[model samples]
Target: MDPAVRMVFKNMTTDLAEQYPALVEPAKLILKKCNGLPLAIVTIGGFLADQPTKTAAEWRKLNEHISVELDMNPKFEVIKTVLMKSYDGLPYYLKSCFLYMSIFPEDRNVSRRRLAYRWIAEGYARDKATADRYFMELVERSMILPTQQSVCSIQGFDSCQLHDLIRDISIAESMEENLVFRLEEGCSSNTHGAVRHLAISSNWEGDERELESTVELSRIRSLTVFGKWKPFYISDKMRFLRVLDLEGTEGLRNHHLEHIGELLHLRFLSLRGCHEIFYLPDSVGNLRQLETLDIKGTGIAMLPRTTIKLSKLCYLHAGSGSGDNEKTYFSKCEDICEMQRDLCVGCCSLDLSDLDGFGRCEAFHLVCCLMYPNIIRGIEDSGVKVPRGTRKLKALRTLRYVHLAWGIAIIKEIKGLTGLQKLGVVGINKKNGPGFCSAISSLSHLESLSVRSGDGLNGCLDGMYTAPENLQSLKLSGSLEKLPEWIKGLQNLVKLRLELSKLSGNLETMQVLGKLQNLSILGLWDDGFKIDVLRFQTGLFRRLMVLDLFYSRMEIKLVEFEEESMPNLELLTLSLGDTEIAFSGLELLQSIKEVRLSVHSYLFGTPKSSKNGGNEKMGKTLYEMMKREEERNKPMQDKVRQELQAQLDRNKNRPVLKVQ
Candidate 1:
């Protein structure tokens, strides 16, 4: 056996005795089978540690067969054992965290702090101290592994991740525990009793029995059932219900859904993706607590006018619909969309004229819709025009997707909206149009700007990159001939995305880009880059960590570069176009951690066969870096542990003199 394997085995045997003092002999037998594999030893030991009783012989035989017969590495087995033990030992709070990982695709890295906060919001971590403390402890105990992270401690402790094996285990355990409600084909009704959250897919055809069984699941708080089942009656027994997501219901009839309004606690309701739900009950407006109402892709073309009664609604995704019924228009939604007093009826081309009746408004929008009855009449009565100049929306702050004929009049009006922080618009004209660059150049508070240039973002190309110094994201979509030359200036911008742009300039742009220092994510797509004609150094993008280039080409100039040049690069995606020379420079990206390549089948690639050596070395380096980071953070962990221990000790030592 390899010496490394032997050393690993010794470490496990010693740890097992300490954890399970009573089951020493059986523990040794388990270790022998594990062959010093930390995974199996920890898993089996942890499981046995949680169990109150287990015979030595019984433990020994199971260990022998699993370790030797299966030829399993003991270390891997220990991981499994510990995971099972931790899962079984978890209180409801941690179990929820473990199960929720299933929501992400396999191998996905979940942020620890984000997960903690989600748990907090879900009421699982109501007591922040307990939740945060245990969250770190779980990671330390090897129940979850910390993923590649920007900081050693996020909020507190490092971001965490679960191994694919452990994640699978969690999923299996969650299903068995009835924590997950997966309503799939051939699903038996027997499992319905224990399910607390149910997700029904599109193929879930329900008969009367299934419907009754569903109703019986009254304890469920979150339900996402797909498919258009018959509009059967639903009872108000769903008292604990919080989220009801039924999308793509293609065959729902006139549902006797009157009682659903009784669920005052419901927070999220989704009727989108439903093809046949024609009418909404007026009682739906009674859900004052509703926060999100998504009815975008439903057969119900118009909404019940009472929907505005749901004053608490925050997110409403009401897209275009076609029907003869009157639609519900919210003074609130209208305000958010920057629509003044009148509703722009897209189909009728009628503008709502009763603008003065709108009690108060903050913002307005009329994207690609010119309607009659003049909705702007109400705003005009209140001394507000279609914001035709760069005017500060002093009373308003967020303006998103306001469409106007790409003209100077609208541009000047937009400048008046100085208070605007989020602004998105499309250029209707394909030719020349006045750009918004000079107008919004001084809007120092602008954080997000998304614009569609005329003839592929051509009119706005020169001044596209100018914005507030604090701007975090700049997204330019639609047709464009090349990457804007001005993009090199926005040093503060962290995220930049260019869509449908066939860019030709190279090297100089790449060099300038490498100097941005703060650039973390760069995605260039829509036709390939003219790499051969470009004279840029690959090593110039030193600070870039994530590079996504679809249908992009690059010329290799450097043969060898230090690993630290692009030290932070972790994710790389490059399309393998009809070029083999481009991959020669891939090695220059020494910090590459994960590479996703879409290579043509016929493109012979040497990286596939030979470049693995560098990847292996890179993996080792990353692992060493992580271990060092962990060691560096040891003191902090110790400090927290000590604090907790002292608190526990003080409580134990406190004087509690019994009274007679």
Candidate 2:
């Protein structure tokens, strides 16, 4: 049994420790039926946990019945029954959503975004964000299990899977309800009744003919093609479909999309991993009712102007989610917003080539301005152009990834979205000057602002810019000569990040930052300071908890926190070179909890080859190329090991160190 499952087993057997001692031997046999599944273990454990005596006698009675069922029914319907209880316990709204998961293969990791979109299309929830709650409920009930990363992340888990044993029950229940069917190529099975939804299982090569024969295609409202089966053209007869998920379908091209517009009721359409596609047909813009459009990794570089007509579309994961992971996080800002309103707006992303159509974002919520200049040029060269008419978005609270290179005219256009609370823009310079900063001050409601002026390029803010008093987080890059004076007025500032290499060596610059009474976390990157020593003045940084310092151009050899400075400091992350610094500052921090030191050293080296046939310029033979590389550990390694040993020997006599 896996350790986690074994721990659950131990916790369950606690009730029988004393009274049903002899029955434990029999209980182990019964537990084997669970196959070490946490769901099964937890389910059976709950049954024992509620026993009147919590004794072996009660467990023994349950065990005997389970034993008889196991012997008479090899499938161990007893365990299946326990799993079914969880499924049956689901709320009315979540039942359909849970069963829908049965379409996916067992042990397959399902994308949370994919589920959110599909669930919304199926009318399981009002929108994509609402549907996310339904998924979390299932995992909470132990009906599904989450991956490791999901559990550790502060961000909610994005994927989950079902145990094989649990999957079997879900499949059986799904079939019994006639809710959906799992179709495969070789399997010659047909659904008995009206199949409302169908999942063409992965590895299925059968085409449209196989689909028509197995199910009444017209009645199916939702169709999900998981693997490589290509339905060149969907039938016009399947009219009621509100959801068409072709996530991993192969060879979806211009012709495949010709009839898509006819499905008037379609709400969700996905082509997330369809790498075969290089361009999308203009007809895709006809799905006016479309709520979510995901083409995250598709090779298609530009979208048609017709997409601007999708007024119903709110969430658009249009470009590389990885290229700008930080910029793409549009939800975090919305979630923490203390203000809430029943407002509506639509957002569209325009590449340089698709500039003919204008998009919308409203009520200070979200407006993603693509801020990279070179990227803007590439997109414009590809066919993206500016919209034909004036676009107004009064409700947008957030504007993300805005590229100022779109022209100052674009800035004037966005100035109308006065409600923006969060904004991230790049491509600023002496040419634009404080006009960008002056425009930023107009967003009085803005709480978070991020501006990046590319490498070696300087942007001057000066006194003309007005910093929003409510601003809580600010990230600034580029050749910022000094922190703008407006920063002193940001009484609500909570987080600050700076990345400018030409930072002045002045200590007063840092002292001013530390004076921010409400600031708790600070990150200094790319030679944030030109000084050799960073000294914290006493009575400053009273509430700061995390301080991250990275080294690139400028190197700091010493960091000293004055006696009363950083009274609540908890974590200090240091990126340093071999220049020796003092460890005494760490002792001065009254609330110091952890020290993460990334020692920068020149240790990694490719040893020079003495005997090499490649030196003759003919290059090495296949044998040499295929040969295992030699490992080198020399006097440096030995010296380091000896020093480490000496440090350990010195510490051995002292008190043991504890890690928090």
Candidate 3:
């Protein structure tokens, strides 16, 4: 027998085979029909793992089915036959969820949360939790594959993708059952009945008129467009559409959605990544059935007052969430640079003397001037302002990136949303900190909370005495004098990120953080601490797997790691200061797999050195100071790399060391 076949049988049916020894021979016969293909073997093994009975009759019956199917079909159809058998064996509850995978583009890494929301919108599951269970069920059965794991350990996976062969079979089965209509280039739109779900691929060549003429648009329960926006597709004809997902669609402007309110049946509307849209029509209030509204990467700064009418709104994601702030800023700037490059390319081909060409060039420059500043401002201050009556959204479970610039009253209103499981708010200041804390204390069910201060200054989060005990993920982007006392009580916290929090060598803060038994991911960025010598004591941070420490202003002399500290640490990211810093106890991290060292150039301003007196380098040019700093830090950077390499060489894992 093939070794792979034997392994699969042992892993899938170890208990069943041991208990029903008489059926072992028939199971082996079934494995032989797999032709040594891993996919076929795994699929067949998964099917058997979920069997209701493990008797000899059941084993022999399955063997006969596989033999008859493989003999009747060609060699190429063997895998398909095996996959179909697994699909056929799936419980009725999971069949529709599996078929729904066909709606996503081939090889697309679908967001787990987005997919769950869509499943709920389609009435496949009762809630997000239930939808997630359905997804994991398919994953366990080898029908779907996970591409990314969730940051919070309790949540199984972050994103997933379908195997190519699995996707092909899913597409075939979905079309055969008339469960979905995938519109692509050169494909006919004629269906046996009304199209319930329409997925327009990026390569779709049919025009809106062609689609309307061939299919009944009114019956489309869901519409998902992949690439360029087709204006005619959003007409009032799609009155029954429950899901309108135009995420990442190009050319989708505000005018294109002027009539969107006519689709009162829209339960899930995602305009995420449609940057061209600047405002939403007030008519959106007519969508009383809307439950999920995702406009994360759009240009809409404020939601219309009409949105308060969406009593069923459960998920509302507006501005950016926690991520690499510098990276996101540079990416937005890169978009502007790309536009400038395009303008330059156009100018090169234009005739200088032609008045029309000059006029076009002037107009393009005008657009650049008008759009550039807004994009930069949006990056610095990103959030959607909710109007009054927000407290009426009692059903809201997720509300992120709400701009407190709207008013302190918004915080008071948010407190009424006791059902919120995740909440993120930006634009916090000293004046509203108390109110914000008050509102947070009222939310007993919040599992994830993110707060960002309006300005990069300390003392904004000084009075927070209470927080939700159920929080699993917490992110704060303000300067705090010290870590909050209440945070030490959060035993369930798994992920924590602190940015611009000028905690200058507060020993109590480290002690408080080290005590979090469930904390696994920690990020300290932009002078989170300004200590000279940092040390991780033994038995501290036992559950941590990822640690990120990035500093631009502080000069640390050494970072000591004690034995038995962070035994599970898998990845470490540390910034090298201008002063020489020794990294002692590097071999203590038994599970370390990757270490990233970053050396940042002081290009913005010269660092204040007490030894050299403050502002002593004011006469020098910024570039000169930056060059001097870079030259001084090079030796220290090399020494750190060498030390890391030497220690990693002796380690069994042979951890990767990166210096940048």
lDDT of each: 0.52, 0.60, 0.76
Residues 1-660 of candidate 2: C-alpha lDDT, one tens digit per residue: 477777777865676556567767767865864657765566666665555665556666666565454335534556766767878888899888888888887567888878887887788888644787777888787777665332112226788777656666677778788777877656665645577787777766666666677777778788887766465436777888878888767756544665677787788787776754444566766787777666655544445566556656544443332212122111122331221222222222322334322212111122212233333233322221222221243434444445454456546745665777766665555666566777877778877777665533344566345678888888776556666777877779888877663553357677788789898877776643446667777888887877776554345555667777888876666554333344334555677655555444333223344355565333333224323221122333344334333433443232122211
lDDT of 3: 0.76
lDDT of 3 at 79: 72
Which has the better TM-score: candidate 2, or candidate 3?
3
Q: Write the per-residue lDDT of candidate 3 for residues 278-387, one digit (tens) a residue.
A: 66889899999999999988867668899999999999988765442422222222464475586576656655554432244343443443556554354434777687
lDDT of 1 by residue, 272-314 (tens): 6564444466678678766556565443433455555665553
Taking all chains together, the TM-score of candidate 3 against the true structure is 0.74
Give the clashing residue pairs of candidate 3, or none.
none
TM-score, every prediction:
0.50, 0.60, 0.74
How well does candidate 1 match the true structure in TM-score terms? 0.50
> CA lDDT of 330 in candidate 2?
18
